[model samples]
Target: MDWVRQNLGHLTRGQIFSIPTMTMIEEYVRRDNQFIAGPDQKYVCSSDDLAEFNIPQGISISTYDRSNVIKLYEHTVFRHALSYQSDSPRPDRLASVAEHKGKIVGIAGASEDSELMWQVGVDVLPEYQGLGIGKAIVGTLTKRIINEGIVPYYSTEVSNLQSRQLAISLGYKPAWIQLYAR
Candidate 1:
C-alpha cells in the first residue's frame, strides 16, 4: 500500500479518523483546500494544490439532456456516452459537454458503478486533445456529482499516463488500484 502511504497526504491529512462506520479507512481523507494541521499528533496528513480546476475563459461547458447527447455526438466516438441510457438496467447518468465555435469538442460523463461511486469517463476530439478540454469537462462533471453528494471516481489503463496525470492534477488519488488480465 505504498501508493496509499505516499498519496494519503495529498488526498487527506491531519484529520482524526474516529468515524467507526467508515468501511473504508481511506474514506476519512476529506478534501479541504486549506487543511492545515497544527503539530504531528497521533494522526495527521496533508495534500498540496496540484492543479487549477478551472478552465480557460471563452470555452463553455454545460450538461446535456438525453436527446441532446445523441444530436451532439452522433458524428463522434463520444456517442457511447449515451449508450447506457438505453440499457434495460441502466446506471445513474450525468454528463457535461465542451464547446468551441458552437461545436461540441469534448464530453465528460459519469455512470454510477456502485451505490456510492460513479465512474467518470471523458472523451475529447482528436484535435482538442491536451488543450485542457478533457479536464474542464471532467472537473465540471465531478463537481456536479459532489454537489449531489456522490463520490466521483476515475479509472484508466495503467499505460495511460496522460489520463492519470489529468486525474491527479484535479486532486483525484489512487484509492483502490488494481490490475487484472482481460
Candidate 2:
C-alpha cells in the first residue's frame, strides 16, 4: 500500500509536516490567509478566549493555568488514548493534561521544544458525545496550540470516522498513514 512518510521533526516552529495533500494544503493556505485585517479584528487564538464554561480545577475552561499544576496531571488518560491512536508515543510531548468542569471534557499539549505546534488529544465525557463539544474542544485546542507556535498533529484508528471527520473539520489533514503489522 502507498504510505506517506511520518516525520516527527517539525518544519516550522512546532508545526509538524505531514505528507502534503494537494487539496487540503490548498484549502489551508487559503483559509488561514484569508482573514480580514481590521483595526477591530481581535486575535481569536489565545487559550484565554474561551469563557463559556466554569473553570475546572480553578482554571479557566480552556485556558492554560500553569499554576494549577495538579490539573495538568489529570490528562494522562487522554494522553494515553491519544497516543494509542498513533503508531507510537509522541517523542517530544512537553506537556499533557485534561480539562474538566466536573468531568474530563478536553485534552491538549505540546511537543518537544517548539511552542508553535499541533498537540493531539481528545474529549467527550461519555454523555457529551454527539453534542459537538468534542469538535469545539478540538477547535479550541487546535487554535490555541497552533497559536503557540506549534503545529498540532494527531491520528486515530482508521476505523474511527467520527474522529477522522472531526480532524478534517479542523483543518488537519493526514500527515502520514500508518498500517499496523503483526
Candidate 3:
C-alpha cells in the first residue's frame, strides 16, 4: 500500500464518480486529430496528423459516460479480448466506440477495480484493426482518466504485443511484470 501511495495517489473514502470530483481532460480527441502524442512521446502516434495517423479513412468516433452500448458489440468476436458487459455489476466500467458506416468496429473501456486502480481494456474488430483505432480510443480514455486525477493502468497477455504497445504508446510504463497460471 505504501508503494501505491507513493506512486499512485490515494482516493478518499465514499468517493463516487461525480462532476465535482472530475477535472477537465486536457484533450478529448478533437474532430481532426485523434491520438495527439505528448511532447517527446514517440509511442503515441504513427503520424502527427490525423489524416496520416493510419486510421482507415471515413471513420467516426464516440465516447460514452456509461457502458450500456458495450452490449452492442459482437460478444463472440470480442469476448476474449474484452470481458466487461454493459449490464454486469462486478466492475464499474465505461466505454468509447469507433464506428464505420454506423457499425461499432472498435471499443475501449475503463474499469475501476479498486478505488485507486482503474484498469483499461480495448477491442478492435479483426477486419478494421491495424489502423490505429486501438491507440486512438485507448489514448483518449487514458487522457480522460488523467483528467479525473486517476491513473490508468493496463494488463495484457504476454503474447499480445499490440495491446502492450498501445498502453506504452499512451505514456504508460511497465511498473512490474507477472507470470501466472490460468
Candidate 4:
C-alpha cells in the first residue's frame, strides 16, 4: 500500500493505471519480492455507442443453457469465456455461442460483476479465429447486456492485441486499467 501511495498518489484514478505507471509499479513490486498479476486494460461500451452487429455469415450464434455451459467449463480452450469454479461469486451468467457446421467453435460469456455491470470474455477455437467469430459473438452478447439495462465491459491483458482489437471493433473503449499482486 505504501508503494502505491508513493508512486501513484499524485495521479488521478484514470492516469494511475496507465502503462508507464503500471510498469513502474511492477518494478517496485518485484523489488519487494511480490509478483504482479496483470496490467490488464478494461473496456466498456455505452448503450448509445453500442450499435447492432450482424452475425457473421455461416456462423449461428445462440444462448447456451446453464447445463450445457457447465459442460463447456471442462474444456480448457474456453477458459476465457467460462469460469469453472463453483465457489466463484461471479459465475458465468450468460453465453452467446457460435456454431459452425453444428460444432461449437466460439463463445462470448458474461459474468455479472456488479449490479449494473457485466464483464464479457470470448474464446474462439484456433481453427476458427480471424473469421469474425470473436467479434460477432462478443458484439451479440454486449447488445443483449445493454438491453437488460446493464453495462457490459471487457478486459484483456495489455499485450493481447488480438483480444483488444476484438473489443474495440465491437465499440468498446478503454475505460480503466488494473493490476493485481500475488
lDDT by residue (64-177, candidate 3, tens digit) is 654364564454455533554545553535566778898778877777766666667788898887888887777766666666666666677646777777767666666654
Clash count (model 4, backbone only): 0
Give the top-scoring candidate (TM-score): 4
Which of candidates 1 and 2 is the stronger one according to lDDT? 1
> Which wins on TM-score, candidate 1 or candidate 4?
4
Q: Estimate the overall C-alpha local distance difference test score of candidate 1.
A: 0.62
Candidate 1 colliding pairs, count: 5
Overall local distance difference test of candidate 3: 0.58
Q: What is the C-alpha lDDT of each candidate?
A: 0.62, 0.46, 0.58, 0.84
Candidate 3 stretches greater than 4 Å from native: 1-56, 67-76, 80-82, 85-90, 180-182
TM-score of 3: 0.60
- State each model's C-alpha RMSD to the native: 13.0, 13.6, 15.6, 3.0
Please give the distance, in angstroms, between residue 69's alpha carbon in candidate 1 and its true position after superposition.
5.3
True lDDT of residue 141, candidate 1 = 78
Using Cα atoms with residue i matched to residue i, what is each candidate's TM-score against the true structure?
0.63, 0.48, 0.60, 0.82
On residues 1-182, what C-alpha lDDT tens digit does candidate 2 reach at each position?
12223432324532322334333344544555642111111112234433332223332344443344234554555552244222234332433333445555655444332344444556555655665666565665656565656566655665677877766666566655442221
Candidate 4 lDDT over 1-182, as tens digits, reads 78678878889977876778878877887887888788799999987777557777899999864456666675667889988775579977778999999988998998878988989999999999998889889988888888888899999998999999888877899998778877
For residues 1-182, could you state the per-residue lDDT of candidate 1 as single tens digits?
67446644445332323233222333333332223222111110112322457775667988864445444435457843434444424453778888898887888877767767777777888888888888888888777777666677777755677877778778776765442211
